[model samples]
Target: MGRHDDETETSYITVPSFFKCPISLDVMTSPVSLCTGVTYDRASIQRWLDGGNNTCPATMQLLKTQDLVPNLTLQRLIKLWSDSSGPGSSPILNPPSGTKVPTKEEVNESLNRLMTTLSRDDDVRIEILTRIVRFLKDSDTNREFLKKKKTEFITLLVGIIRMKTTTKKKMELVLMATKILDTIKPDRETLSNLMLNDDGGDCLTAMLLAIRRGDQDSKIEAVRVLDWISYDARSKLLVAEHDGVLTETIKLINVTDSDPSLIEASLSFLITISKSKRVGSKLIAAKVISKIKDILMTTEMTSVSVTEKSLKLLETLSSKREGRAEMCGEDNGRCVEGVVNKLLKVSTAATEHAVTILWCLCYVFREGTAAVERSNGVTKLLVVIQSNCSVMVRQMAKDLIKVLKINSSALSAYETKTTHIMPF
Candidate 1:
């Protein structure tokens, strides 16, 4: 939604607070009044009832009945507010009504009409795309119908994105197209087709453009689409080969002010792309290791999923010599120390990857072997062996300890001293 007003006038337009559903915190499409005198979205309240919650979400009071009284008057007023488009008022698209699911024939006709208009008029194309996005968002049936024409739909959306237009209306069209494509989630076959075609590359280029120039919502959608494409191995390499793809992704990860979803998407893409040795080297050259270390050091990165991903990427990067060198400090040993500390602190998967990284450092790089000794990593490796870790992890820890004991006589003395106290 938006606001429109004359430059000389002082007018503020906003959504009425009461129009929002308390449960969902979004504008209520089907308003229902409970016995608690609280109005909520019908679907949200139904889900609450289905979850066996007899208490109201807002008031925390027991409900006399699960019956939802439709607030027809309030619904009419909300509809009127949404439809009132004028100066200082923005048009809010209403969610699809439950009773108004379009049939297959109607959907096909609309798709045909949209394709026909897309080539001639950008404004009309945007309007059609808005209606399509609303339909796809509100009704699963509409989405299923569109899935039948997935290739055609993706082709049209890519065309819209490739079209050169700097006008606000055209950008809106591109944003809507991107949103619709994300929602549709084209199948693997369709995605493969897009990749094989030159237009597919253009589609990727357009998404990258959106990432650089579009708003947060558009940027998030673009990232998601790229994530989808990166699912397949060939597609992942294709994306990695595209110029500025990895660079933009690393930049997105380093962005201090970004949505968590954006960061997660970038991390997901990196994890996927890191599977390739060539791309892994490129990522290390992009300073992805330092970026990941910074992310791991952040207190806000508390999600186990994010931690696991970061560790996974680090493990991949550590496979390369340059990656290992970057993670292994010159003489201070902070880089290797930071990784060795994660041995038993994080989740099991994270611990496994952490150990894997330390293993790479100790065995792959000669400097890493000495650095671990100086950072007291041998003590941590002994602790890992004694701790309740997996068979594979324990074995890896044992292997590293053996190598350390054979290579560094000081580690051998430390092991002998602690062997009785902490048996391995």
Candidate 2:
């Protein structure tokens, strides 16, 4: 009777297809992740393991470790979903579960449902899109399933942002639309075509509008979408061709007291897009250098990722003669002073990027030597050579030492205890 009741209650919105376990094909109240990245209900996986199975029933791959990490994100999403649906929402069973990943049939069913719901009002669209974002973010399997139907999803999402709706639900649906595209993410081929295709399915245009929309979260997702596309050199160039793209991105980076994560995303997009000289010129013209310097010098930059990215952007800018000139500023090389101060203090990656920036300005350009000296860059470079830094970084430091004229003769007095100038 209890089993029969559980099956009959399936007509309720207990699960959204993705919340099902592969082993029992049952609703997952407690989704746990395996080393192979598959999620299963706790009881089902425990039963499977106790039954002498050492493989993930979903992928049939050998289990690297038996420990099951709680899929807290999925669990929370499931909870939020159930809470929002209440007890009287539309019919939805534990949805469908599949081996390895969601079956093609199951994914098609979900997307088909999405298409229908999207045709409704903005309130409905926002809820469904939010759920979809959660699903995409929940697991690699969900995204893998969506990637197969990227074009349809992209078109549908782009259409939502392009819609002239006045319902104005929370998150505005447009933001959620951008988030969906950010998560599912059009591949390089799809990105390139979106730029070329003119049939009103222009994701690039939607992103441009999202940036202009000025909603902080939406703009971040919008920038991320552009950043993903710009990872490819050709696409980077293609993105640079769009009007106001660099300007808008720089605006994001230059904002005051902005969210740290948003700044990181904006910087990442800028870094990828600035790969070409033309784009670099545009970014430089937009005063991206001083703005980045301000960010590095002003913000606490507790996030190592943000700090590394900031230095890298500066380093990328340094590659251009104009950039090198900007970094080796006329303002007594304050920019150079900043880069030199970062050496050996941050992560290896950051230290490496700082070293490269210093190498370019102080060595290749030979313009920031005075500032490097002022910042005690010579002392740091000596330590860098002696530290367990990367071979390339250590060598760069060595070259910078030579280029900065920190030879034995100059350091003779500092190392009076030794006949040879050890540091130099």
Candidate 3:
């Protein structure tokens, strides 16, 4: 463990993005949340406010209430994570051995209490829900025990969320509910009822609200819930048909200083929804192509997982003619160049996805040859043909070379054997 003191600090753990102060980008000393649902280190925000700034540093929203509530749950989470990682982890964070889980009765009572506590302050409700989310996240046993009461909890949560309430009063509750549903992973039939015509789409509507107005956690959970909801065949169309779901999700990608986890969730959700052909044109209409290019072009902001998924999503979108045209035609050479760049740069999965995309554009469609040639894609293709890549990838690389009308005889210098025949 790295030494920790009052002012300067260093640590081995890769601190969670949210754990760091927005202004300082260091692990928060005393984390606090503002009215806008953004959290920051006490000293950093205090300095910001002392500098005569009236807007939130993160959202730039005009300050309505400058009240800074101590984010006790977050503080505890940080401590728990720190303790767990820094050599002397508490039993709660990393249990020594498994023990008996809570009985069904105890779980039911807790759900019933949350259901009946309408008059309870929002703070209490959030705290209770936070503990539950943390507990569920800790291990599989906690999750499995809670799974038995998943239906009751979901029903109660639905009722609580559906109440006539103002946005400010209910956002936390709704967000927590979304997180719970996302964690518990309710059955497809249950999600279909809540997200589709059968149940008036209340849950789905709340998801949009979370995406639009919620804090970072809420936004991530919202997309996560939608990602799960999209898995049900009926809900995929509902998600696509919803006027704002696709638009709002695309908006998440463009937020200034956007969280990578949120973007990852958004990309995953888009991938799931993109499986249906009906949403392909709509996604293109919403400028998803440009947004994805922005992701691929910036290797710094994205994680390897994000890179892999982006390529996969791009490949999925390539199945549409408009998607292909947008990438190879309207985008000049950037799109093809990005694909070529990933040929040997990323993982095996990413390389696989990239070659498939290149093949579609340069070979199958025959419209991307100029773009590929401009990108020196032939060089990348030749490299792929000679790499220790999958057999399918090697063949696709050669086919792409032929499409560009490049001579394959040059392979003799690189490959000892004919690519047309097997190598021992």
Q: 188-218, model 3: which lDDT tens digit per residue?
A: 5776565554544666677788888889888
Candidate 2 residues 1-424, lDDT tens each? 1123454654432345678765444568899999999998898778677757787765567887899999999999877776775675444545443212334454465466567622343433553465566567668887877777757777776667666534445237777877777777777667555544553235565677778775777888888877876756667777777777778778777536677788899999888888787889889888888877776666464477877898988888888888877777656778788777777787888888888888877667677888889889899988777777666777677778888776656443333221222121
Q: Order the candidate numbers by lDDT, best to worst.
A: 3, 2, 1
Q: How high is the lDDT of residue 89 in model 3?
A: 35
**lDDT minimum window of 10 residues, candidate 3:** 93-102
- Candidate 1 has a TM-score of 0.66
Model 1, global lDDT: 0.70
Residues 1-424, model 1: lDDT tens digits: 2223443243333557688765443578999999988899898788778856787766677889888999998999988887776665444343333323233543564577666522244544654565577678767877876776857778877678766756777777777888887888888557645644663666677777888888877887888777777766677778787888888888877636766677777898788778888889899888888777766666564567767787888887877878877877633555666666566778888888888887767754555776667767777887776777666676677668877874555344333222221111
Which pairs clash inside model 1?
none
Which candidate number would show the highest lDDT if scored against the true structure? 3
TM-scores for all candidates: the values are 0.66, 0.67, 0.69
- Residue 411 local lDDT, model 1: 46
Candidate 1's C-alpha runs over 4 A off are 1-109, 139-145, 199-201, 231-234, 330-333, 364-380, 386-388, 406-424
Winner on lDDT between 2 and 3 is 3
* TM-score result, candidate 3: 0.69
User: Model 3 misses residue 258 by how many Å?
Assistant: 1.2
Per-residue lDDT, model 2, residue 194, is: 56
Clashes of each: 0, 2, 0
